[model samples]
Target: MIGFARTVRLWFDPREIRQEGVTPDYRFSLANERTFLAWLRTALALIGGGFAVDQFLPGLRWGWRVGLALALLAAGVVCSLRAVNHWVRCERAMRRGEDLPVSRFPALLSLAVAVVAVAMVVVVLVGWEG
Candidate 1:
């Protein structure tokens, strides 16, 4: 059971993230894992938010409803995908004693959420029927 659980964890986690840059300090590796988990949490929140909007907000027009749901879902997927890649890259950099990688996804995600929030406000205030 323990082995199976470990396997499942490895499947989701970047456990092998240190393959390229072995022997980095445990603290660095743990930090990398924490960062990866943070990204995963963000992805999960985005996905959950999408689901909540789709299920609970029935007042929205079909076009707007579906668009918002898809946007959130896509953002979630993007964040998850980027998380793994970023984890691997950062781990490798750490192993090589290089600087941490610059993260573009956070900025992109913040911008996306901001745009969606603004659009939602407009829809609510203006009664956007389409």
Candidate 2:
């Protein structure tokens, strides 16, 4: 059983794998992985914030909840798709010995956050009056 467990662990261990040669662009690959993970975290945060808004603003109208859910789901989907595309672009750049593709994530995320803020303000105003 111990031997079996060790074999299973070895299968999942990154150090156990050996590449035939040094990748000319290992730095780009590592950076790409980091960027992908960052986008994934952003996507998760958007989804979580959507649920939180619904929970915290129970008095909010159905329209507001729907809008929040749609916005967050859209943001998550966009981020996930962008991450995959960015990874592919980085890999291609590395293979061709070109500079890695630049990221527009910061700007895009900022816009999404702004939309969320506006939506929150609208919700608060409507809730107060109703």
* CA lDDT of every candidate: 0.80, 0.72
Which ten-residue region of model 2 has the weakest summed lDDT? 14-23
What is the C-alpha local distance difference test score of candidate 1?
0.80
Which residue runs of candidate 1 sit more than 4 Å off their true CA positions? 1-21, 128-130
Error of 1 at 30 (Å): 0.8
Evaluate residue 35 in candidate 2 and report its C-alpha lDDT on the 0 to 100 scale: 78
lDDT digits (tens) for residues 1-130 of candidate 1: 9954544454566555445455887898899899999999999999998998788778888878888888899999999977877877776678778888786677878999999889878876675444
Q: Best by lDDT, which number?
A: 1
**Tens-digit lDDT track for model 2 on 78-109?**
88766766665565556666777787787978
- Model 2: CA > 4 A from native: 1-22, 103-105
TM-score of 2: 0.73
TM-score on alpha carbons, each prediction: 0.80, 0.73
Top TM-score model? 1
